[model samples]
Target: MEIYNNHKRLYIAALLLFLALTLYAALIPAYKAQNDNAPLPNSKPLSEQEALGKAVFVKEGCVACHTQQVRNVEMDKFWGERPSVASDYARNKRPDIWRNTANLMGSERTGPDLTNIGKRQPGKEWHLIHLFQPRSVVAQSIMPAYPWLFEIKERAAAADVTVQVPEEYRKNIKGDIVATEDALNLVAYLQSLKQVSLPDGRPVPKFLYPKQSTPDLKGMGTQTEDAGLDGASLYAANCQACHQQNGEGLPGAFPALKGSSIVTDADPKALITVIMKGYNGRVKEGFAEMPPIGVNNNLKPEEITAIINHERTSWGNNASKVTVDEVKAVLAEIGK
Candidate 1:
């Protein structure tokens, strides 16, 4: 009886060991196959600056909290997409970052999924502020403050805004460079996000971004409020070539106007000024500056207002419109 029991125990252990080896052998290739693609779902062409930021991201241990991969489950919930392919990161990348398997899949979602976060907000200013003071915009954000990332410096009161460097943080009168140049690299990287819906036949509109909408016509369309219609139309004609029909702007180059406090919720005076004066100076990533459109004296005021109204209402934001008189004031302020 004792001999028979020992033999039975040995047989059971051997069977279990065999099954475990089979499972491991099966999963090993599957893991290699997925990781073989490296940096999955990241399709954008990365510039040198973006690549620098990516290195920082890896070094900063941000990968532990935030993930770049979008799983089938996660991709569908956030913005409907699919499992990533290895080829997405092949260009401008080495050692392929296809990380959907180990660090990303098993990690906790402490921070938001970074798969499409690059352009979620668009402007560098917004990122600067959030980094400067997290609670300022997102009340409950747990992300660490990165004030060291900004450079604070004194800037001259130039009607030409080029004097606004450490341009990432402070606007208007500059103080000191708040964040380091490295910060801007990360901002550039984050602003690179784009939606995958474009792969299909569906075109996305700026107004259709899935954010809570807010609108109030109670005190809108005054003479000062309606100033940018023609400017808007002009922008639609000339600027849309790069900024795109959607307000989000281009992934890496054009900064967005949708949620730009400068455009949507800031002083109406600034909005008129930018349209009539046509802004220069880099707002986001590129060293390339915006050419002035305010040079068109022949344009009508009401038309500019219509454009501003469309933009304010187009993005999921609600605000009063700029009027003709307001445009004139901004025009006068800029001496145009």
Candidate 2:
């Protein structure tokens, strides 16, 4: 009761309490985190090139859309083998002086999680082309292209790394699309995002979506001689993501598969090759390049045949069905 009359004493007490809370809540935790000794297995510090690439990634605001941390929830398993622990971020830090969000563990995930992008998509060529034009590989992708990070040269020099851009996409540019040092560094950083496995005794969380174990649709077998391939189901499951259910494809990004010449072609050679090895931009206008679904997605010969048949027969196209033997022969000839 007497303290109520002592304003200065009360003010001093409140200030001391605030400082104590600040120390308990912030400083202590930061100090413990900085001193953590247990890091994830096989996790390495960034190389010089990768560090530069990280700067480029931060400069480009990549963290705004792509999250680097994988949460413990089951749904987040798609991004990494296991949930990210404190040790996973131990090696990720800015210098002592620079302290603007040192951990690039972004909040919003407008783009897919980049925590394990290095494992998901590792091809240097793919990253280069995708950076040059997101639409080139993913026609419907809204990711901004960083063309300014590349240089257009009349011809590639001995040291220049050229990417596969459709002629039309490169129109009015005098030279080939070559990766700049920044671009190379940026890709290096992207490629360094593999998820490190948790140390022993830490249980890996179960996947939210159980892996499919049963045999795929009738025609989904990888064997060359297997019959009863389910073309419709296979197409629905795999191709429909980009080609659309109706086979119309996304205009300007993905070509119309329903009435496309390649789909209706009698030979079926091109279709098989496209699915197996992937196709880069060929024309000067429209239709971004198609990544090799078979290889990247691990599609077998029978699966490829089923997809070809589905595209040929569906959407009023009257092309003949392809056999597994034919697909196998093509795969052999093309050395897939």
Candidate 3:
């Protein structure tokens, strides 16, 4: 009764209880995690610029919409090659003494998971344009544009990294859009978000409730006769994001395939070459470089033919369809 009535004793007991709870709940767990989970061998610490970008990402509330973790679920498989493990984030450290922002594995994936976005979309130009205006690239993107991360300059200097905003989005602004240092830094940090490959002989975690399989035509060649391959479906899966469903691409940002000279050309070499090696020649014309889709996506000859045929035939195009043999020959000739 005396101990309870004494203010000093009551305060001392409360302080001790708080200390014990903190030590057991926070300090002990943190210490165990630090000791038990070593960073993957291939994972490197973030560079200075990337660190700054990370701060900007947090400041911009990107964590609210985007998640960095890929769960061990079939649906999450699109975000990463393998299910994320603890060691995937082991290289993360506290930003500073004032902030414990080491774990940014956000919940609620309003936006697509960015666990392996670096590998999925590695184009700086794409990121720049997307940042300036999300709708420029993805017509249906619900993400907010971060226009403050860029500046409008009358004429960009040689040192300036300019974003080629589509004319529709830039109609009000009379100057070229240049990426600010923070924007570049943010892109750098985003580009650095690649999933590290596990060491050889390591048992990779499998995604649960595996979806029924379709034949993977990435590495192997499919029959020349289409063989149940739907060209429209292939185009939707691989090309629709840029070229769009109607084949009219976003003006100034992506070239339209509808009535395109390359798509309708009698010779298929140029078209196949562009698909395999990619095209950067249109940069001056405000078009971002097309990534080497055939190579990067590991598209087989039949798949490439399907995409090409779809482009050549659809959207009022009357060009002759390309065969798998022609595509294979071209791929071999180009050494792709």
Candidate 1 stretches greater than 4 Å from native: 1-42, 71-76, 79-106, 156-174, 195-336
Question: What's the CA RMSD for each of the models?
Answer: 12.5, 7.7, 4.6
By TM-score, rank the candidates, best first. Answer: 3, 2, 1
Residues 1-336 of candidate 1 have per-residue lDDT tens digits of 464579888788889999888778887776576566544242557677876776666666666777565554422334213343334343433535664322222265777666655433445655655666554444446887765665545652433122122232243544644456677777777666543433445343331223332343456654554432354555566445345466765444457777878778646777666665566566445523443444432234555566667777776768776566666666667776
lDDT agreement of model 2 with the native = 0.77
After aligning candidate 2 to the native by TM-score, how far in Å is the CA of 47 from where it should be?
Answer: 0.4
lDDT of 2 by residue, 194-256 (tens): 877776897776545554543644555544433566888888755774566778765444567
Predictions in order: lDDT: 0.55, 0.77, 0.85
Q: Between prediction 1 and prediction 3, which has the larger lDDT?
A: 3
**Better model by TM-score, 2 or 3?**
3
Candidate 3: worst-modelled 10 consecutive residues by lDDT: 219-228
Q: State the lDDT at 215 in candidate 3.
A: 61
| Model 3 lDDT on a 0 to 1 scale | 0.85
- Candidate with better lDDT, 1 vs 2: 2
